[model samples]
Target chain A: MSDTMTNTQATGGDGAEAPRGVENLPMVKALNAGLRQAMLDDPRVLMMGEDIGRLGGVFRVTEGLQPEFGTDRVLDTPLAESGIIGTAIGLAMHGFRPVCEIQFDGFIYPGFDQITSQLAKLTNRHEGQLSMPLVIRVPYGGHIGAVEHHQESPEAYFAHTPGLRAVSPSTPNDAYWMIQEAIASNDPVMFFEPKSRYWPKGEVDFSSSAVPLHASRVVRTGTDVTLVGHGAMVTVLLQAAELAAAEGTSVEVVDLRSLSPVDYGPVVESVRKTGRAVVAQEASGFASIGSEIAATITERAFYSLEAPVLRVSGFDTPFPPAKLEGLFLPDADRILEAVDRSLAY
Target chain B: MQFLSTDGVFSVSEQSEQYAPYLERLTEADHRRFYRDMSVVRAFDVESANLQRQGQLALWVPSFGQEAAQVGSAHAARPQDHLFPSYREHAVGFVRGIDLLNVLRLLRGVTHGGWDPKDPTNGNFHLYTLVIGSQTLHATGYALGQKLDGRTNTGNHETDEATMVYFGDGATSQGDVSEALVFASSYQTPQVFFLQNNHWAISVPVTTQSRTPLHRRGDGFGVPNVQVDGNDVLASFAVTAKHLDDARSGQGPQLIEALTYRIGAHTTSDDPTKYRTQEELDSWVAKDPIARFEAYLRSQNAPQSFFDDVDAEAKDFASDIRCRTLALETPDMSLMFDHVYSEPHPLLEEQKAWLAQYENSMNGGESA
Candidate 1:
């Protein structure tokens, strides 16, 4: 195991089981545990979404919550995405902290107007008289061979908009701590949960949060190259780092927890040391997160760079069919190829 | 059907008997007050339109002939009730205690929104929503919150809270309106959808916006609805009073379609002469809500001094806008960064600081 994984495992608290700490859990279960803790911590925290009550959500991420919290707190909203988001905005105005779920990344467009125009602009329009303490949990990205409208990476759309905080956790531990922190935020947040990382098991420390909500962390340290990515792309970069080490090349990996207000502190510090960098993502490269990170690194650490910052991301096209998602998504091989190219220069 | 005819007579037949008791709730003083409000709002409306023409305002949305419908329905709402208005509800906002100068600020291009709805001075009226039919969903959501907060359906009509949202004929076509109706019906929220079917939405006639009466549109969504002759302020007040009571008493959502007319251009930017005929405008102008209400007040033995006092008050209100409006200063440029996020945001903070330093540099001042 990488030193970062080993450290996280040792300090990890028990998921579902607390004080004594947890051994292992999938990212989805960690999120469930975090949600329960938030509900226990604050009565104002409530949830609303389609199929989130009895069905416990399509991915079972919200399983068993309705039974524990009751129907009023854990609402099974109508199939209308716009209504769900729109009403959640109202609920927030009335002093409730609502965590809404958009069933799929592709299905979120129905609520796009509410999210971008109303929810995003309301706090600004109110001139800070009202605070929208709400979190929109969107299960995004592709890895499962699901059909059309099942998987997407639309975080860039929100990150580009002001008055919204966009974030994605790459590990079970991060998911557990970050979700609670997001719920505690007084401003609106777009919580982009990686669906592909839902079933992956990892240690979660319930004792304390490892890092701030927006801080980027160096997961694996190396002297030659720095690899930066967020969400599921962080996992691919880590894997590529492992393979790169086997070939006698040193590669460091950074896990970006917050997608917006992107700390860039840790990223710039790492790029300054390594002198070369590669950023990866599952989203299309055009005006995407990868393009942004790469540009900033070049601007901030121009003299330290030995090579141009490389980006390994999906091509500019539609999400594609389930069978073709493998080709469309970035994997360890694609990231390694970029790393090798950066090392060559 | 109208309980008060254009000739200023209150004629109640068996068909209108249910609404008579609601009229009994109002006194002679209330009748005179409604006439005063209608006249005052009409004068203010005319002054504002003139301001727009003289370049004192960026634009003006005239409430011209929709006075009775606005005044009556606005009075029907209890002090605790929350109201969401479309752009042209100047008379309603005035009734709700929002400083009319704030509304002037909005049209004067000083701010996107002129007043803070949370301030007690602004009353319980929310901000004006320029997007058609958008406020209906907000009002519905707020009604949902009211239900969840246990403010509604508590068996006490006077103490219970309700929400009222105003939209127009053309806004009925918006998807948000349909969704609001669906959610309101599903949740059984204590609310009222007050739609002003003013004969035109810009250049589009009511016939173009809907094939059926707008109130009937509520029926498909399972909300109990009614159509009132909006030019008759008494009918407007009585019908809204009953419906608001029903909503607060947990009878669920109600829809009141006030059949009225917009006797002016949609905005200062619009020219009604391009699309509408003079005959149409003259016909609606003859059925003016303010004129009929004055006739009704005079028959009730209101003194000529009452008319003189209102005219004097309205003239002062117009001059207040003309004199004070130009003196309203421009907002600070830094206000742009002040409210984008409620919390301390790193990016905005950085940008805010950067702008300050840049401005200082331009001014040949020292920068820290």
Candidate 2:
């Protein structure tokens, strides 16, 4: 190891070459670091999925992993999402913590049947006698300027399943810490990594106090309104909050790390102070995570509400082309529009 | 013993003696009971298909000719043993004690999972899995858990547990199936991989799906493999019983391929006539599993009352299915948010509130 990168420090310590420690890495680099750390920490940790070995994944998230870890630990699997997950179940049973990658978000449909029906229910079906210690990493959401099926947001489908826990990370620190947390969890976790934000750089504190994957984080605090988002949309919500502040409005931003077993403490607390909220996502507005959040805020924080909780999300239409994606995605403008509407009410 | 056979009569291998005691334990009453279960399940299957045709059900995967394979294999499993079934295992679901109406609810699109796999009433059998070969790995993993818990073959037949997973010939080509076999063999998990090679997987024929046979694939992974006359209930029962015993006894995994035919469309959305010929359908009809089982029962001096009782029970069961299916109501859309998380989620709660207001506003001030 280089002298500059020797310590697992959150910040650089009087070193010229070291810039901001691990936190300054991108989401993809943070993930690579996290996987390496987990593998080094535990002998049982293994990675398996299509193109995860030689090809280093289509996103190059697993780039150079096979050469570093060897083929036995980092495996290149056959082209089958269902097989990837199904086999991961077996590997988990054999005392291996298999972190599987389902090449893309849209490609996971073939494996969805196994995930919801088998992987999710196995532990509960056996009354906790069997715990599927597995992680299914899916590159989800629109914004890569991809085609029709490739950019779909299907987190609600996995989150809806009973025995599965779904979690997604936004920043580099959360990405690094949560990936380790998810691997340590005995429950099956659908780790949805935002495909669009993989290249965005952030500060990751590897040795910093690690947060629970199931807990929500209060990214930025404000009082006028609570803006809730997760995965790639967290960055958008932050930008919206910044713009809102410039316009003489206060916005509290909540990055929901966990989709299933969602930590409502932060959200409820933020909303209690703010008295208004606007949930945002890249998934369709109809029957989405945003829809779920909007309902919960009304029920829990009904008396504190100055207006109905609004949602700024993708339209109830298919994810459009690369050119129209800017219009299709939930941006700062759309989020601000929802904030304006809620404040108007 | 007709097509896909070298002799006029199907032969049982000498190794099959291990299952002879269990096979002999099945009395005339047991045979009649299995027949009745198959009949009722088949009735429900047909009714659901008709319901789909009438636009009541969104889709129905018919379990017509594969009834004997499901019934026999399912019967071989003890109550303590768990099952992981593919979507078309109606007869297996019936044997596992699932309410026939619940199966219909899934086809009718009223519920994602019509019954709870963990419910005691479910008899340790999981809900149907629509994805092709995924359940095999789950079953294997669960069996590994059973072994870890020291619950396998405790010398108490009633308490000892094994896992049986159902899939099809088409699924044999899936990497999940092969990988599942590899893990099961390596861990020596108490799992029985039951493959019902029902001739066709959608439009692909069995010939196109595999060469050198499906059962042989299991042997490559070190799992003991066998092929049975799927239409023959006795063969299916004897074979499944033996393999299930081997698994429960800690002898590792086994693969059982039941040779049968689909006899109907893959699902209500499919049209078999467009791809297959009338002659192919007629050939499988001659080897109808239910008919052969009924004939075998008659030859065993089964009373006429047995047939009459089974038919009457099947009719009542079919009537109940029809009534319950038509009377089924769509679940509250908000209920979708209920089970997403075991703990209370603010996100879901907020969404539910917005939906309530949205629905109320849509209905002009009435809650849904």
Give the per-residue lDDT digits (tens) of candidate 1, residues A248-300: 98999998889887999989999999999999999999999889999999999
Q: What does the TM-score come to for chain B in model 2?
A: 0.94
Model 2: residues with Cα > 4 Å off, grouped in runs: A1-84, A87-188, A191-345, B1-21, B153-157, B366-368
The candidate that achieves the highest TM-score relative to the unseen native structure: 1
Give the C-alpha lDDT of model 1: 0.87
- Position B233, candidate 1: lDDT: 93
Number of the top candidate by lDDT?
1
Taking the tens digit of each residue's C-alpha lDDT, what string does model 2 give over A179-258?
Answer: 87788778788999998899989888764657667888898989999999999999999999999999999999999998
TM-score of 2: 0.65
